[model samples]
Every structure is written in structure tokens, then in C-alpha cells.
Target: MSKKKKAKDIMPLLKDEPITEKHIGILEENLQKVPGAGKKGIEKALETLRKLKGAKKDETVNWQTYRNEELKFEFKYPKELDKQFISVVSESWPSWPPKMTIGIDATETDFMCEENPNYKDESGYGERERVKINNAIYCVTSTSGAAAGTKYVNYTYLTIKNSKFITLTFVLSYPNCSNFGEDNKLKKCEAEQKAFDPNKLADQILSTFKFISQ
Candidate 1:
């Protein structure tokens, strides 16, 4: 008699097999056998599987390189994503240092959030986390919230090189536009809930970031 397959056995197949509803059905069946596996457990497992698949897909994506000679740094972004450079001016300090802003535009299904002026403190708008790339450490501050009826999520990476600050930001914004008023709000919330994961792409791009030493 053949033995029953476990989630571990099935998980390895995901690397080569295309993920489909059938694959999820198989995972759901095996997830039940996991100790303490509840609704949350199943959801978490599914999320992990999706992200893994996404990373795999990103492996085949064509990426373009962006190099800054003066800053002595470079990074890669998807060829399809738009890149923008902007300068911020401070009112209080005449000697306000120069900073560069890189914005990644959103797709039809996802929204990119821009920087918000109303956020007085970091805690009020975003959370801070640390990430390492190419043996270098960076501080990333991120936030997800709604503004002017539009939903937005953003991540900002900060690092210092040669006594100057280097910042890279990624923003996702979704516009809430529907004629149904409250129903529109509900739909927007639901859309946000179902939006594509942004962190995966962000990580893909950031992984290629490296500081070129002069």
C-alpha cells in the first residue's frame, strides 16, 4: 500500500509545479494535520506559499540598473516599473542638505503611497526595521494607511556613505473612486485587503542595491 503524502512532500513540488487551485487544495488538506493548525495557520501557510511563488516569478523578470556616479551607489529595479528622482527643500534650514527620492509607480491592481506631511512622528505613520544587503546595513521606515480616501503603503531605506545620507523610497497607492459612497468605501477596503504583496518586489529591488566605493 502506498503511504499518504504530507505537506512537506508537497511543498517541494511547488518549486517546479505551477501553483493552482488544485495545489492549494492539497496544502489545505495537509495543513489540517499540522499541530495547532487553525484558520490562522492555514492563512499563514497560504501567504508563505504565495510569496515563495512570487519570488520565483521575479527571478525571471528583466531588471534595469540605476547608477549614481556622484553618490557612488547603484541599484536595480524592474524594467517595467517607473523611476523618478526628486529633491526635497526644507523651509527652516537654508543649508538643508540634498536628498534624492526614488518613486516606484504602482500597477493597476496595487497602490503606492507617497510621503505624508501630516505625520509628525515616525510612530504615527510608519514603523522602522533593519535590513542587510551586500554586507551593508540599512534602516527602513515604512507605513500603510489611508489619506484623502486613497490607500497607500510606503517604505523608505536610509544609509550613510562618505558622511552623507542616502535615502531610497518605495510607495504604493490605491485610489478609492466609486459612486456608491459607503459601498465604495467597503469595496476599497476589500481591494486593499486583496491587493498584491508589495514587499516581495521591494525586497527584490533592494537586494541589488550596493554602494560603489570611490
Candidate 2:
């Protein structure tokens, strides 16, 4: 007796076939069963199918430019972020320092890593890596820590442009998962494993940064 064919066995045969409404309906029904299929799984599957059928690629991104006329610099950031431009002051000083900060509230996590002991000094905990963007080389360092029951991670890019030191800092917060480590650090956090990764999005925003010449 011949073995009955399974739906999985027949799926490969339709790989190159044109997608129809009926086909989409069947896929949608089974989408939840796919490995790693979560809330957006079906939508992503449909998008993939559309792309396979030669749908137009959507490369649109909404971005806003920030400029400082006196400083002679500018950069672009995603419009979706809750952002602000402000001057950072020293702990003891009330006056604004010479440096300007483009603060972005990622809002994904509630943990504030800024106050963590690991990031208390100028040079952070992580190893510095060199990154080249727009013909400029930047030294990047990242660190993560917890404060007041909140966990946070930060990346700082530093470079000298036109005889002035420039720094761009990116900070994000994540839930403290008790399932990982006693200290609840990111290295052992299982929540970080399943969480939506935002590092790529941060990189995309950083790529748009430029120092405009006066």
C-alpha cells in the first residue's frame, strides 16, 4: 500500500505557482502553525507571497532632519521616534555644557541603564569598535546595566569633526526577565532572546547621520 501524501509534502510542488485567493486563504489558516509564527506571521507570509509574485517593493521611510546652524551639523532620524534636542549638563553644574544631545525615547523598555554602575564613566564597559559612515570613522562602544529595577542598554558613537568632539548616543530599555540571571543582566535574559530586536533599526537611523559643512 502507498503512503498518503501530507499537506507539507504537496506544498513544495506549488512553490512557483501563481498565488490565488484560495491559496492565500489556505496559507492564512495554517500560518499560525508555522514555526516562530506570532501576531505578525500571517502578514509577513502574505507580504512574502506578494513579493514572490513581483509586487512593487516598498522602500519608503519617513524621516526628519535635525540641523544646528551654529554648530554646522545635521542628521536624519525616523519620524516615529519621540525625540528631542537638548544640552547635557554635568552632574554638579546647572548650566548647559558645550555638547548637544539628540535624545530619542525608544520606549520599548522601562529599565533605565544610564545610572547603572557599568556606564558611569566616559569609557563604557563594552569593547570599542570602529564604524565607518559617510566617509567618517567613528569609535562605537555599548554597555548595559540596571537601576531602580529597570534595565537599559546604550550605544555611543564618538568622533572628532572639524576640531570638535562629537558624540551620538542611543539608549533603549527592556523588561527585566527573572528567568535568566540573579542580577537580571541582558547576557542571561531569556526575554531578550524572544524580544523584537531593535538594533538594526538603530543602525538604519545612524546611517543617515551626517555633519554638514558650513
lDDT values for all models: 0.53, 0.50
Model 2 segments beyond 4 Å from truth?
Answer: 1-60, 79-124, 130-138, 159-166, 179-199, 211-214
lDDT (C-alpha) at residue 68 in model 1? 80
Residue range 79-171, candidate 2, lDDT tens digits: 443312111222333211122344333332321222333344442354455655646555566676566564555666655544455566655
Candidate 1 achieves a global lDDT of 0.53
Whole-model alpha-carbon lDDT for candidate 2: 0.50
Clashing pairs in 2: 109-173, 111-150, 111-151
Candidate 1 C-alpha lDDT tens digits along 1-214: 1113333344566668777767677667756665653445455657767777566444524676778897567777654433121112234222122224433432323322334444435423766666556564566666766666655555566655334455666555545545235775656555654654445555566666677889
207 Cα displacement, candidate 2 (Å): 2.1
Count of clashing pairs, candidate 2: 3
Residue 174, model 1: lDDT of 49
Which residue runs of candidate 1 sit more than 4 Å off their true CA positions?
A: 1-61, 79-124, 129-138, 143-148, 159-166, 177-195, 212-214
